[model samples]
Target: MFFKIFIFLLFFIQSSYAHELRPAIANLNIYEEDNITNATLSIRLNLEAIIAEVDINHSNTKESKQSDKYESLRNMSAVELLEKFNSKIKNLQNKIYLISTNSNYNLVLLNIDIPGVGNTNVARDTIVDFDIQNIKDEDLKFFWDKNLGSIILRVNSPNNEDLYSKLIATGKKSDWFNPKNKKEVDFFDNIRSYTHLGFKHIIPKGLDHILFVLALFLLTPKIKPLLLQVSIFTLAHTITLFLGVLNLIKIPSVIVEPIIALSICFIAIENLFTENIKKTRPYIIFIFGLLHGLGFAGILNEIGISDGLFISSLISFNVGVELGQISVIFLSYVFIALLFQKRLWYRNKVTRPLSLIIASIGLYWFIQRLFF
Candidate 1:
């Protein structure tokens, strides 16, 4: 039963290219065409997931009942996917809400750019454009439906650059913003929102990260060694995550992912040999942590950070990640370590087998990421 369950998990994890359902990012630009105000909206989203009506709340399409439908849509060519979208244009229209001067505007389809079915395992980026007309000189409010999930929204005006930007929650209306005026955003709100996102990124969505943390746990349940390694890991990742977001250190995911897998494999292999924390283990873990931070930066880059809220959001996200790591450690202690750490056969019966399994999975992931 355990083997079967593990195999099933591996299959789903492999299929989940993005691993998480990232919030769609919408950029709206307003301009005057012959004295008439017109706005163009370009939103980046996973069209296949939307078309299949997959429940994004569960992290990825593989977790949905409509997973098969999503796969079929995901593999469609650009033109083929456009046709599928047209079939449900009305439903799609209702998903995005735009209000100006208390008047609602219907978005007219402009164009869609869908990439070819390249690497069907990875989620494809589709840019859909729409034109919004009949804008008044009042606050514009945007709302994304619960069915459509969350969205990161940005508005730009001819007179002002980056007029407004916010991460709108599903089914919740945004704070009103006018293009002509400068406004101050709530500081605490940005912190609270991103902290939640950062936590979510690790707990349920970040499978690779979870496994890496578990590999650390399997080393030993001793508080001093465990705490020391985790602290070093956290410090190193924090440094790189900040530098990565600033574009100071820019390495593509292709290089970073394989190294991350190797790190997992290395730590698990070490566990099989060492009964306690090795003298050089902390330094090695620190290096791996730096690599993992680059991975975290990729997610932040996708979500985007407004110039005004950069520091607060970044710090909050790191805090959330730390909290997630702590949660994983706490649970492992309660369930496995507390019960088994003191057993005479603990090292031979528990840690050895688990470490081997982790090492195997890590090696498999490394090979898959490198060649496939």
Candidate 2:
């Protein structure tokens, strides 16, 4: 009824545990000494996440076969973790890609900061510093392999003033910035970039979000009802996505994720029971959308949008999300629902069975996200 990859990811979640994959945040600062320019890159990351080699595409760490090794590293003392990191030093640097217009600069580890094994309950935030020289004064470009996951790169001036920041998408090389000249990205380009980000999130990346949208469609096969629900869900999430990113209404992912799973469970279960659209369904969905928006915010927050691009970025991202949800509905209707919705047994045979599977998946996610 749903995507095969969705089914695959469901099994992934089933075997996985509590750790979620988070982006590594890196800040690059430029320093000038006697007319020469050098830069220091400080990255705050979950070293264990990289050391244990979690699958980059999946959202949860437990999805990886090496998750056991990841957990073991997570439980290690600061010194122990450093030893693990040292073992992978050469291979790890090969994973990082940084270049200028003229040449590739090597990343030399200056030092590192690792926390003492404090809360084995949470992923430890390890910060590492590296030095890269700039002799030719060429603009710098950054690239991240999927294996390294996503990166939130911020550029700073020697005076400590913010120069530029971006959530560099995977495998995509960033615009050449710094080295006394930052690349100018026009408004339309920003829209395209953010929109792609939003679409990517819903289509392949956001399994939980995809389930919610599909559940909405299974409830009412008609275009009108589905559109109404989708529109309301879109608007509600847009409001909270902006608010969540701006830090006006911040809700931790820990609380938001479980509730999001619960919302999907509610919708899928409702599909199994209700024949006609409920008047109150939209209202309930509106509230759920708000919570989902907060979950959406976690991505942008990690990415760190610039003040100037905040409005454009948020609107573009929401538009992309809408496009993504619409794509799901459109494909389902064209392929599956269209041929079957008119049948007398459609609701009983198609809708109920699919809804049951979806409901079960949601329930599992809820319990896993909550207490696991």
Candidate 3:
């Protein structure tokens, strides 16, 4: 019966997150100096998606002979357009921040610090990087979001003028390049930016992390054990995140990503079969957390961090991640405990199908990560 249910869920989840070719490109580049840093970022927003969303929202206006697509877009609300652009930016930022935090860097935002901007209608490049002196091994992994077609980090030598030139050249190659007033960006003022990035990293975009926590909750559903498990998972992942980012312990994404996917599957399957939450679950989660941490580190390796403040960056990033995880747990209990815990109909009809479905999706991710 369980197997049948699991198989059905496999079908359901595959249909839900079917991989679509993304419409945007994002990349991160890092270069270190004794105490100064430079990071060049490129994000090409999916103009199609943006336009589609706008068209859908404001379709009541009558068709006119003067309707030029570009002009129409320009006429759209600045608030609405900025909101959409910011939403996409925030998601990319969250993912990048998570990767950076895992990689052991506290990425502070110096300013808007973009290279160029002329008109508001056209998509503009948003470039930001920091200068630091204390480089740590934990701050070297590269992170990219395959789903979103966004690149997070590309690190280069601190004083390598050639590398810097290459980054600029590549930006030019993209037809949408808009070079504007060059402005100096201060790295220290980015504390607030770092905090915002960290908060979003854990809360909204950390779906995989949230799912991991949920799997734990469904299995234990008790206070003491749940707290212990959360702590262990957090500690274990943080330790390995530092190690992996620092390059002391290196694991290929070919190995790490698939296993991370498998961890999700394992937790979900266990929820169905295991009655007693083992005292050793924390230890096991710690081991798997280590793997996930490596995966997280890979993300930061892609985004450049200033070498001067590497340790503090690491601490701050990890702290943000911990806070994000805790928020997930609190919210899950608040919503799920109230909605489903008291209802047997959900426990059986809904929970069974839902878990099986989610697990199947996890299984699919496992295979894709391993084989493809």
Best by TM-score: 1
Our tally of clashes for model 1 stands at 0
Looking at candidate 1, what is the lDDT of residue 37?
Answer: 82
- Residues 1-372 of candidate 3 have per-residue lDDT tens digits of 767866755654343223121223344444555544445544544332333332322211112222255345444454544554454544545544323334434444433333322343233333434333344433333343433333322233434321211111111221111112112223453344344445555565455566677787776456887888888888888888788768899877888877887888787787776656777677779988888788667755554344544565566667777778888778878877667766756556545555665676678788876665
Candidate 2 deviant stretches above 4 angstroms: 1-9, 13-24, 31-38, 44-81, 94-106, 111-126, 132-138, 144-150, 158-161, 167-172, 179-183
Give me the candidate number with maximum lDDT: 1
lDDT of 1: 0.85
**Candidate 3 root-mean-square deviation in Å:** 13.9
lDDT per residue (tens digit) for residues 1-372 in model 2: 455645865676454423666678888888897888888888998899888887877777776788789889989998998998998878877777778767888899999899987655457899989888754566778876777887888887788766677777666677778656544557788898789888878876677898899899999888788889998998899899989988999777889999999998999999988977799999999999999999888887777766667799888988888889888888889987879988998988788878877888899888877886
Against the true structure, what is each candidate's TM-score?
Answer: 0.93, 0.80, 0.56
Between which residue pairs do clashes occur in model 2? none
lDDT of 2: 0.82
lDDT by residue (153-205, candidate 1, tens digit) is: 88887764777788888778778987565446789988998898888888877
Which residue ranges in model 3 land beyond 4 Å of their true spot? 1-158, 161-188, 343-351
Q: Is candidate 1 or candidate 2 better by TM-score?
A: 1
- Whichever of 2 and 3 has more lDDT, that candidate is 2
Stretch of 10 with least lDDT, candidate 3: 162-171
